[model samples]
Target chain A: AQSVTQLDSQVPVFEEAPVELRCNYSSSVSVYLFWYVQYPNQGLQLLLKYLSGSTLVKGINGFEAEFNKSQTSFHLRKPSVHISDTAEYFCAVTHMNTGFQKLVFGTGTRLLVSP
Target chain B: DVKVTQSSRYLVKRTGEKVFLECVQDMDHENMFWYRQDPGLGLRLIYFSYDVKMKEKGDIPEGYSVSREKKERFSLILESASTNQTSMYLCASRSGLAGGLYEQYFGPGTRLTVT
Candidate 1:
């Protein structure tokens, strides 16, 4: 079984300020890590993913995350956030087998950006 | 753009009524999924299909059933709608690639309110 946790339920930041959303996972085997963002009343869009190779993964909208095996974490960071970046973010892990590929998501961290 | 289309943008159902939510994908993708989003709970997978007529249970399948009669369509069925079942439902599709890297595409979700 795999589980994901987003350490914070909400992270409020000002426009142009740096922000980080923390995520951690517990799994017995290798798994895929992902970040998704959801705008108001919209469905989730993939932000980034960590499969293999380099730990640093860059995603759309100038967002990125680092996969830390030692810490069992994959935290997302943005050098600067925008007012449009205000939305709910989710961290998820996918099990490899079954191609059933279940995504266990964090409770989510709402990113609130203000001017 | 990979388009995943949900049949309804909003739905209002009475308790104990039977409900059906439909999803369609245009990219000929091999996988389709159904999920529900609730406040404080992020997104929980309800069911998924990897191929025509194939279905698998997701993390939260207790109150829902699903069907995949065609390759590009997946439907989630609520046997008996309950107030607790009210949620924003999402449908997604993934184009499988070699080396296990796949990006999921999402539809604009359906907001279902069970009264």
Candidate 2:
């Protein structure tokens, strides 16, 4: 079974400060990695995804993530966060060869960005 | 742009009531999914459908069922509402092409509260 793990439950940061949300996954076979952000009372929006090419993936809103094959980790990062970036971020993984896209998601990390 | 829409943004139901959550996608994607989001639990897939009249159970599917009668619509059913079932419900759809972006587009989400 594919599983995703996000170590931090919450991370507090001030405006203009950099932030990193760590994610790790356990899967025997190759998997697709994704980052999603959920704003208050809304659904999740895809941030970035790492499929087969270049491990360094850049996503919307100046967000990016690196897929480390050896470490089995995909970590999201932002050089400088804004107050509007405060939201719950999730890391997800899915089997690469499956026709059905059943994503296994992490528990989530709440990014608390304050001014 | 693909658009996934849920039937309700917020719902209040009493325990034991039968609940129906509907999701529709504008794009003709072949895969649809239902997920529930809870604090510290992120999003856990309850069910997914790869085609009409086809459904598959996810990580958690004890009290839930799903329907897909049309190519663009998927419905989730809660047999009997319970307090434990109260949470933000999200619906997502993805393309089934062999090698596509395969990113799931999500709806605005339905916040269901069972009393």
Q: Pick the candidate with the highest DockQ.
A: 2
Best by lDDT: 2
Question: What level of docking quality does candidate 1 show?
Answer: medium
Among these predicted structures, which one has the highest TM-score?
2
Q: State each model's CA lDDT, in order.
A: 0.90, 0.92
Q: Which portions of model 1 miss their true places by more than 4 Å?
A: B96-100
What fraction of native interface contacts does model 1 preserve?
Answer: 0.61
DockQ each: 0.62, 0.65
Q: Score residue B100 of candidate 1 by CA lDDT.
A: 34
Residues A23-95 of candidate 2 have per-residue lDDT tens digits of 9999887888999998987788899999888999999999999999999999999999999999999999987
Per model, kept true contacts as a fraction are 0.61, 0.63
**What does candidate 1's lDDT look like per residue over B1-115, in tens digits?**
7889999999999999999999999999888889898889888888988889988888889989999999899999999999999999999988655423686788999999999
